[model samples]
Target: MEASPILIAIDFGTAFSSYCISVNSGHDTSKKTERYETETVILFNENQEFEKFGVEALTAYTKMTSSEASRYYFFQNFKMELYNQKITENLMISTMDSKQLPALKVFSESLRYLKDHALKALSETVAESLVLPQDVTWVLTVPAIWDNAAKDFMRQAAQKAGLIQDILSENLILALEPEAASVWCKQLPTSGFIEEQAGILDKSTVQQQAGVQYVVVDCGGGTVDITVHEVLDDGSLKELQKASGGGWGGFSVDSKFTAFLRQIFGPVLWEIYKNEHPAELQKMMHTFSIQKCTEKEDIYIECPHNLAKLAAKNKDISSYFSQLEGACWTDGNIKISYEKLASFFTESIKNILEKIKEILDTPEISIDFILLVGGYASSSLLREAVKREFGSRYKILCPYESQLAVAKGAVIFGTDSKIIHSRVSALTYGINMSRKYDPLLHDPKKRRVNKAGDYTYCTGLFLNLVSKGQSVEHDEDAQYTFFPVDDDQTEAGFRFFSTEKLNAIYIDEPGLKEIGSFVLPMPDIRLGTNREIHLKIKFGLTEIKANAIDTSSGEVQKIKLKFMSE
Candidate 1:
């Protein structure tokens, strides 16, 4: 007898993936509440597909095997794919199928790999109990930036990955990775608020400073994500505004860094980056990975002797790439300095700071604290950039376990039943004004020359409460008002847009599964449409809200999940 597939929470991130499944006591033995996590990478050989799953695949790749793998390796958190305009048809998972396949298909297979591993973990844990495959439930997390169309693509991928059609309901878990990281950092705090600030509040009986508002400037390998978040009243969160970000991460820096390295160290260096990277060559790789350099700087990185052996069997390259460990390029007996590497990474660090400064200058927004997370967030160059701009406006809090913050926060929130809890504030929503566009005009940028007032077809645009990271108590009323464009039509389309920045879920390093999206209708509304579009966005559980303005119009649009009339 085997235990049923259990309920699990997977924090499938952009750089790394993790699954935290609940483990209870066995049948006939008390159910114990324990949990475990696994890194989300799937490496496999063409013939040894069965041998590849979870951490096992990572180790097996280094071993000698008669069967050729075609070197198929998949890593989730390849979130950088969302913005790349060049990736249209075949993804990195192209070798699997003979023809050019939809990127979505390859992405789904990546997710399938992770889910399959999670199911295996659960199966092994509860082997004594009776379990069924259908018993397992899964919840996945996505970045809070993608729109509905992308998310719709993700839903289809999930279905192909074996989710029953009946259970296939898409819910957007709009977590700002940086904010999520901040929440995780706050939970593991070493020092309280600054001493003088803390004393002033206590001695004067003033309001307690809620906590730190860490601005997470996540400089990832491929993209740079900047997020600002504050702790909520209920030990949760409140995103000050929409997460401001751009395509600036570690990978972006790496490209430029590689170019700079090639300029200085010559082209022979790139051959070492191909195929597998050995321990000794890894030092050189890091040097090449740096973005730029400063005056009077020297590039000397220390590497092991084993790189020569690695280079011999893996990548066929210049003499510098002597196979010492894997496919790593190394000196016969020379040394490399990390000191030079740091100096070379400054250019990338400079760009990241400029982006953050622009975010700070946005209307009605100023980040108080700086949070450092993600792979590149640990870079000393990035930290200095943050320090220069912030200048003690708030202290920078870097968690030792910064990389794992998102996975941990997601898992914690997942296991929390009360976390999804919400309140219903209003019984029904009604537009107070009817077709009133006879209002203010003359912000020429927004309104036409001869219009009653500035009216947008997007009733969804008139949000009254909650921008992004704010955690609300369940059943709270989400209300907003809309002024008609021209008073031309009575009916209005109430489309609901996702409150996220990027709603993409990646499957592996070369493939991306669009499992998350925001559902909104692009309504062709007219002028003078003065009507309050009232709807409710509850605290817990994410859902869709589409609208068809006039049932007679037959025009379907993305609406709030809650009923418009009920």
Candidate 2:
């Protein structure tokens, strides 16, 4: 008999990355089964060579020689590049030493490291004979707000890293981070008001059985994704509102802290400290990261003797630090007050609260509870702020081990994907086609004579398949039939576009963006432009898929749409 399938989840994050594995077994009842055996991926290298990953990477970087450290490339928060709308195919990652490396290569290497680590972990946990890549299913968690191009980029990187043979295959699944966390939270035990409410609500009565509605606030290191869902009687979840978020995350707070540091130290001195003492800078940032998650009233960061020495060399830096408020250097350590630290979180926290308020204000959604999960969600400061703002209106619940929710939930998702019954499309999707010219609607400049001498408009009209904010069921496919525009055309091309407006009339309209294109070979087009091709575009899945059928010859073809960078 074949061994039970193993589910491995990779939560590739901005400030950090982690992976988890779970055995597919219905009999496991341990409380920890739903949680991920997480491992952080932090790469460290000396002499510009790839060395180690995870905790080992941190240890190696700490012990490396200063000369060696200066030559090393320590990449952190590189995942933010994918979220950048301005990213291009030629984008390259810049190292601390001003060295440049291909972004794709860095991402692929990180995935490769995670894959190997998961394999090693499975081999140690399970019988050696039963451990094999083919027996394992991989689930990758991505932010829901990411564009199709970013998602496709990650898929391609995973393929290059050997994480999956083919991304489109069932062996590799993509789970949206927010949705995955929601699934995991639904399975976990709740407490306080939410638990009491669940008990009081009748589970059997149809009259009181609309199920509880909740909003998931997934606050990660890079982004915060919020979505509303309503649990059904059958325990499945239906998305009641579209997923939305911004780049206001924990890293943004860190950015503010860095700015504070710049304010104390002159820009020239700060730059020198970063370049000359990369290892110390990394250690300081790591310390700050740990402290930010705690409730400490004051954080005492070790002032690297070298940084102080560098500062001493500049009289302006010394003068600036001497006059800095809420911070003081003593015993070679800088003590920053909680008030100062909390100020760093103010902007990011405000942005998050505004987004949640915006979602709640929607006339269609009525949330009874709020579920907070993700790395940033674990911050006590953030939790208290959210509660103080919206606690009265909704029961706020943050589960144990919330930071690992997305990865662990990804494992659960790999085991059973039907937990989420539906999703709301974030954008309106459609195809571009030419329609008959109308004097009242079409611009005269767009009018042209067809091959059959018929007057037609060549306007880039949008043929909508899915509308923004529309709820779409899983595995839903939208089908359309179109004929070739020209006789003897060797191939037919289809352009897919997405827009925020539901009634977008043209592809070039504002807020309309071209996502990708599909092309179908029409070798049998001797039948002329009258031959029709039936195209089916699948939505409500992790990624969109298209299938085209040549109606004339009954030949079916799968078109792989390539999402281009805007």
TM-score of each predicted structure versus truth: 0.58, 0.90
Clash number for each model:
75, 0
Candidate 2 — what's its lDDT?
A: 0.76
lDDT of 1 by residue, 232-281 (tens): 45655545544456566655555554454344334554344332342223
- What are the RMSDs of all candidates, in order? 11.1, 3.5
**Clashing pairs for predicted structure model 2, backbone only:** none
> What lDDT would each prediction earn against the true structure?
0.44, 0.76
Candidate 1 positional error at 360, Å: 4.1
lDDT of 2 by residue, 456-533 (tens): 656688899999888888768898988876777777788988887986887888888787787778888678888998
In Å, residue 470's CA in model 2 sits off its true spot by 1.6
Total colliding residue pairs, candidate 1? 75
- Deviation from native of the Cα of residue 423 in model 1, angstroms: 17
